[model samples]
Structure formats: structure tokens, C-alpha cells
Target: MANSPHGGILKDLYIRDEPLKATLQAEAETLPHVVLTERQLCDLELILNGGFSPLQGFHTQAEYTSVVTTSRLPSGALWTIPIYLDINRAHLDTLGAVPGSRLTLRDPRDDQPLAIITISDIYTVDRTQEALQVYGTTDEAHPAVHYLRHNTRDTLVGGDVQAVNAPQHYDYVAIRRSPNEVRQLFKKLNWTRVVAFQTRNPMHRAHRELTVRAARMRHANVLIQPVVGLTKPGDIDHFTRVRVYQAIMPKYPNGMAQLSLLPLAMRMGGPREAVWHAIIRKNFGATHFIVGRDHAGPGSNSQGVDFYGPYEAQDLVLKYRDELDIEVVPFQMLTYLPDTDEYQPINEVAEGVKTLNISGTELRRRLKTGAPIPEWFSYPEVVRILREANPPRDHQGFTVFLTGLHASGKESIARALQVALNQEGGRSVSLLLGETIRQELSSELGYTKRERDINVARIGFVAAELTRSGAACIAAPIAPYNEARQQVRKQVARAGGFYLVHVATPLEACIKNDRAGVYARAIAGDIKGFTGIDDVYEAPSNADLVADVTKTSISQIVHEIILLLERDGYIGDR
Candidate 1:
């Protein structure tokens, strides 16, 4: 029989009363609309489908307090994570949110009504306490802590959601199984003893060996469950990772393993998250769960220290194994014994024995260099999928972002570079010069700080999309703020390589060389908030290439950029 759900019963809030649901939907049109963020959407779907088995809706203040303090619901059920609906303080006041108040929850992707939430409590949150208690740190470097400190709202509105419709997904329909579906699948497969393995990364030979070993030791079938929802920033995207998973599924012994996608928006909460995952897997009918070193750990903080101890997740899961109702099958890091042509736990190797292991950084470097990835390290099919997702650096798309003073030879250098690249004729090149982008993408945006940030963000989005499609994007914007420039770098880096070129032409030189008289107008007080005249320009300290247009010819500048690209393997020798 399948293991019972976390709270002994799965919560179902789908709108079964057609007439009442119709009335609620119509009434929602008249009520305030609260668009669900990605995290909230994941929570809502899981709640509706009983993946978050006991969570009827977003938590009230009492439940939140209980869960955070004790890792248990108010009903004394195991629920390590707190699910809350947060709204801006102003929005809460405008909506007159109080106990018993109703609001419409709309999907941000489609603006379709997904649920109607009745406010049960409105309470202030201590972000630091929540972060420290839930994630074991109050540091903003932690992604969840950062979200709590900066992105989330000050006021949290607790509510019970009545589902109008589950959120829609356009991809991977067959394997996007709900808890009930997974339970049914387990039954169909006669998987009485199942071991669940959770991951946010692509699977390779080491991972396969680890999971298979765990399943064998536990005498259970394997369920390779990977999170397809919001993982830590900079993780391999689910689309690519899922393809990698599909490629490696055949390597597992027939009838010994299965693959499923879990739409979990992980907080990277380390130890607490491991317990949460165990309870979730138990609800999915798994008898055992594999928790390895640093399970679900977000790599490190800004200080270069691990957020959790290496064995912290395993220890915590072991502490709650009985209550979680799932066997905790802890495993050590696996290393390949090249001599034996197999893998074993790193700790199990003999004192004089040699072992082979590839760090993630080393693997990425090898992939970028098109170096040999030995078949012993990973299967050829798996390597092929990864190589396609992350092409060799020279073959991959990239963005060259130019930031400088308004009249600093950025446009000229960009145009010259575009022409030079076009002449090379290897890849598609796009030029987003300052004036062109201001006229096209940001015509309505002004030069205010927020507007400038938005403008740069728009450029980043465009560049990232183009880079993903294997096009070289040359974005020349007077992105004067360091923070905004850094944001764009991070955004574009995810899709492809990002190189920043600081066109460091002197301010006086730029003003003197200006033919459009925009800089002169800014100095003459006709133009307000112009960069480098009245407003300050925060120069990039870590630009990949710094070209002084006054000292270097345009051709030289273009050559310098090409040389940087070539050095970085974004382009072949030219």
C-alpha cells in the first residue's frame, strides 16, 4: 500500500461546485486581482494536486509560526516549509484585506483566474528571523534570503485558496506527474519499495551509479525526481536538464528506475529542505529517499563559505526519519575508480588506491574547451545532450555589452565591430546602439535611475533571448550604473557568455567630440539628468576590456574586442 500523506489526508481545493465557482469567478472580476508570482504558482498547483498534501492553501500566521519554529503544522503534522501569500503593504491597505476578505488570484503568465483566496490573517514579517530559521542564514547572498529581504513584500496575507483552475504548462505534459499521479504510477509499476532521488542538475554516470547503488542497498526501485520549477539562480535550466535526464534514462536497468518531473520551487533551505523533500517523496508513495552530501544545498555565500555543513542535510533527515515516514538512504560522494572501471563511495576506497573525479568547474572547462570527456566519467549520450545544451565556447552564442559616457565613441566602435563581425560571416550579429535602442526599445523611458535600470533590463532580456538562439548581440547602451550593468551581465551570462567592454573615453574628450550637441545641451542646463554632466557615471571596475577611444583608433578598438573574444573562445582566431 502507498504511504499515507504528510497530514494523513491530501488536501483538494479544486472548485467542484460549478455554480458557486462560476459565481466566484464572476465575483473575482469585481474584486482586486493578485497576480501569482512563479513561486506562488508552484505552491498553488502543488496544493491543488495534493503534492503539498496537507496544505489546503497559503498559511495563516499561527500555522506559519508553528511551521517555522517547529517544522510542523499547527495540527502537529510534518511540514518543514512555510507557504505564505505575501502582498505589498500598500496593496493590502488598498484592498482592505482583513479576516474574511476575498481576493482573486490570477496567473501572471496568462492572467487567467486560478483561485479565489479568502484572507485569514494579515501580519508583519521579520525577514531576518524567517531567513535565519528557515534557511539557517540571514545573509542576502542566499537566494531565498535575498528574495525575502528585497523582493518579497513587508506584509504577508494569509489565506485559504479555492482553486478555480490549475496553472497551465505547455511542456513535458507526460512526465509532469502530480502526487496522486505518481502514487498511481507506483501502483501500476508494482513499486512497493521505491527509493526517490531528487536533483536540480543533469544526471551523469556518477549520479546513475549513486542512485542505482542506493536502490540496491535498500532493495527498492529508483525514482529519479528532479525539480522542474524555480531552482537556485544559475542552475542549468529545467528544459535542458530534463533533456539530459531523458538521454540518461535508458542507461538505468530496465524496470529498476523511472523518471518524473517535480514542479518544486526550492528555497535551497539545506537541512530543513531535505526533510521537506522526504515528506514530499513519502506522499508520492516512495518508501525510501536518497539524501547525499550537501543535499539541496545552495553552493555558497558571498564569503565563499558553504551555507550548510556537508552532512547537515543527511543528519537532519535522519533525525526526522521516523516522523517523515520515508526511509532515509544516505549516501556519500561517489568517485570513479578508473582502474576498476566502476564507481564507489569516495570514503570506501583503499588507502593507496587511486580514484578519478571531475569537479563541476573542471567539467565545464572541459566542455568549453571541447576536451575529451572520457566514457568512464559519463555516457556518450549524456555527454552529447550536455554538449548540445552547452556548446563549446567558440561555437556558443555570446553578448558584448558596451557601457560608457553618452558621447564616448560607443556607437562608432559598435558599428565598426558589427561590420567587422559581419565581414567575418560566421554567426548572426545584432547591434543595439544607444540611440537606436533609446528610439526603439525605450522610447517612453526617461533618464531617471529607475527608468535607466528598466531600459538596461529590457536590453538584457533581448540580448539574453538572442544569445540563447545562438546570435551574437552587441548592446551599446550608456548603462552608467554599476549595479544595472552587473545585472545585465548576470542575465545574459545565463543564456551565453557575456563580455563587458568599457569604452572609457574621457568626459571632456566626449563633450568636445560631440556633433549632436546633446552633451553640450546637458552642460547648458537644457537637458536634465544627463549622464556624466550633472548625473554621475558609475564606471565598471571589472570590465573584460577597457578601450579608451581617445587613445585607440576605432579599428584598434574593434581589434581589441575581437582579440578578447578570441582569447575567451567566443570566436576563433581572426
Candidate 2:
């Protein structure tokens, strides 16, 4: 019967009676495959149409020029160039991997096996490219050329934002294609090692010092790409930040560096974020991304001991370097020297003579409070940025922020949660005391509630207001019991946003840090109703986020809180 078809399943067709047996069978071996998206397909089409010219790999110098070296200053001592993240995708995605297959081959560097990954949902790379004279050359007629580029997406790859772009407040970047378009624009440049710098803060002398140091150490070019988005509240806004950066451009080594603004929403997750930042830099065609101490901390953030310490991020990058292909350019924090009145390496600060006391906060505060930023603090352009960003100072958030007890932090953050009525300009009843059990019905002050109907009322009150305002709500007055906090979380989840940020500190740590000396006095039988004693303060179970004040500053905690709110979709990503 038809020569018994082929083999077992095929021969079964001879019966011609078995279900589906009469149908012809074909052997199509199934293997791993990658799915392409409309956007990815478009990108692929552009890439293919772009005409691969002896393209070896993503960072292939033979194919594309990494143009950071000749853009900076001091001839060759320092280099900073523009960063466009789309080119970075080639760096991280193509490293030791095969396209359209999960089978990653062996590594050429170490002959080690590489993992295969099938491409899934593809994300668009917000980019546009322009042809310019390539790295190390000012001649327009040079055979090598550079392509100016940037990502369209608003996400900042590896840094936290200090503030976000506001239509009324800042100059919105124009999202326009070039009126004069050049086809096959990037065909001419010779590629070299590219290094990218990520900053939410405006570029200052200290930053410049660190960048130049890293460039010289790595023998690569530099690209200064600062975030143009929501940065930390009260920190320099992007509009002014960009101006300062642009002002300092002429001072940089010409043809050795370039400056560009990266539009991105920062996550502020410290160590992990550093990795993401490096990848973005690589996508923008950089061979390196700088990692400094507290690299991505927008506000001090609750990272008690400097956002996982300086080396942690570097370690993370090094551990995963092959996957990212972007080198880790690590260095100590840069500080300004006063005796010589120049920026110097922190390590080179000769013991403790200078004791550079200037900090971003001190600088911002001095500017905001109407004090001049000293030359020792930042570059003149940087001062202008801070001066313009100084705007107005609101200290209501500061008094409570400056309270001196463990109980104060818990109280402040809790109290910090306000209702729409309390919105600065809402003109509505500002602060309303949200409590569970009404004191009118209570005879015993502390003992009688027994945790019954406690959190429910508090949650109801908070949720009702949040639902009413269509914004997040806050409930103060120690939410020590885990069950009570869970109730609040559940209630808030249904309404809008719910975050259990346990501003925790070890009892001993708190006592040691008890600036009010409440702990010592409590031991001497002075103060009663103290949390963790007299009043039971149950530790949180599985808190959504924790602002451990044991070592972090209030600014940092606030930054983390903002990040937590953004992550939970409670607050806008700005």
C-alpha cells in the first residue's frame, strides 16, 4: 500500500483505519527557536539593510567605530563621548551566543561552554544614528566617521533618577528624526574600545576627575551620559544639570570625549542597577561603564553602609562581565583638594590634611539656603546647576526628618504618609489622625485593645482616604504587629498601593544610636511605653521594602521609599 509508506507511523497508514492514520506523516524535528517581534523584525530589517560589512561581532571594531576617545581633552589624557543605548544591545546580547537558538557555543576566550538562550519578547531600542567624523579626528573628510545615537525609551539602564522630566519645569527633549538624513551613515568609522559613564548627578570636577582617571587607566574613550529624568527630589534637575555638563564640554580634552543626555526612569536598586547600567552603556557602543562608591544612589537611600559598598557593584560586573562584554572601570570616589584647589583622587588626599568636607547635600543645601558653592566643592558650571535647581526649600519634611530617636524614624515615615487633603496646595484639611479604636470608648490606654479591631479600623481609614483620593495613603502610630501590617497591606492592595517598609534597626543598634539617650534613661527607669520594651514592637515578616536606618541617611531612605513607591506602581515613575 503505497510501498508501506516509510516507517512505523507511516506504515500504520497501511491499515487506513486508525484515527489520523490515513493522513500522510512528515518528520519535522523540533528544536529550540527564537521568536521575533514586530519591533525586532524591524530592527533586523534595518540591520540587514544596513548591510553587514565584514561584521564579526557586536563590539567588532572592524564593523563599527567606538567613538569616545577623541572627544574629550588634554589631547589623549581624558575622553568622553555621547551614549546611545541601542548600540549597547549588540554588546550584551551577542557575546558568546548564537541567534535563534538556545545552544550557546563555547567561549573563544577561555574555551568554556556558553549558555544558549532563545529570544523572547523583544523590546524596541529607541535610537537614531547620524554620521560624523569618527574617533580621534576633527577632519570632516576623514575615511572613518562617528555616528551620533540615543535610545528612545525612557528607562535609564543602570542608574537611579534624581527627579523626573516635567513639562512645565524642564525643557522637554525633542523626539524628532533628523531633517537631513544620511543613508549608510556609519559605514566609514574604525572602532576602538569605548567607555561609558553613567550619572544621575550633574557632572562636576570630582566626577570629571574620576572619569579621566578611569579613561587613562583603561586606555579607552569616555562617554558622559547623564540621566535626563526624575532625579531625587531637591537634587539638581536635568535641565540645569544638562547645561552644566554642556558648559564643561569646552574644558574637556577636545575630540577625546562627548556629552549626551540619556532619557531614562531610574530604579535606584544599587548593585543590580550597576549591572543594568553597564549593559546600557555597552548598547550605546561603550566598552566600559564606570562603577564608583554609591554609584547609583539618588538619595542616601536606606543603604546604611553605602549601597552595598563600592566593591560590590564592581564584583557583580566582573562576575558577569562575559555576559555583558562591557568592562568594569572601578575607582575610589573623587574628592576636591583645597590646598591646591583641584580635584584629586580620594586615596591621594594625603592622610587627613584636606578633609574635604563638601558633599552633594552640603552643596545643594548651601545653594538652596542662599550660600555660594565653593570652588572646592564643584566646577563653576556645576554650581550654576545647583543654584538654578536650588529653587525653594521646604523644611516641614526636615524637622520630623531630624528627630533624634528610633521611634522618631518610625513615627516620621508613618506620619509622612499624607492624604489628598494634606496635599501641599490642596487647601483641604491637611493632617487627619487615623486611628482604629476611638479613645472615647476606651478606658484602659495601652492594654485593652488586645490587637482586636485595631489594624482593621486603621486600614479602613487609610484605604478609604486612598480610594477617595485615588492616591496612596499613610497610617502612622507604630504598626508593630505583623498581622496588623498584613491587614493594612491587603486593604491597601485592593484600594491602590500597599508597601510595608519596615524602617528597622536592631534593638542594640537603636540603643547605641539613641541620640536622645532614651535607651540609657529607659534602663534607669525613666521613660516608659518605649517600643521594643514596655510597648511590644513585633518585627515585620516579609516586608515589601526595608529602610534600615541603622547606617543609612534620611535622604537615602527617602530615595528608597520613592523607588519602592514607583516599583509598586503607587506613585508615578518620575
User: Which structure among the candidates has the greatest lDDT?
Assistant: 1
Off by over 4 Å in 2: 1-191, 230-235, 298-307, 392-574
The local distance difference test score of model 1 is: 0.87
Which pairs clash (backbone N, Cα, C closer than 3 Å) in model 1?
Answer: none
Where does candidate 1 stray beyond 4 Å? 1-8, 16-23, 403-408, 438-458, 477-487, 506-543
Report how far residue 149 has shifted in candidate 1, in Å: 1.2
Residue 334 shift from truth in candidate 1, angstroms: 1.7
Best by TM-score: 1
Q: lDDT tens digits, residues 251-338, model 1? A: 9888998899999999999999999998888777788889999998988888999999999999999988788778899999999887
RMSD of each: 3.0, 20.7
Q: Kindly list the per-residue Cα lDDT of model 2 for residues 1-574, writing each as its tens digit.
A: 0111010110000123343322211100122222322222222222221111111112222112232223222222111222222213453354332333232222233332222223222233222221222122222221112121322332111110110111121343432111011111111223265467878776767777778778788775566777764344345556677788787777667666666555444544445557656655544456677888765643332333333455666776667666555577777777766677776667767876675657766765676455666665567766766665553232111111111125546554544544321443322222222232334332234533354346345545545554444433444445556666565556545433455566776677777766878777777778776656666677666766666666776556666765654453334412
How many clashes in candidate 2? 49
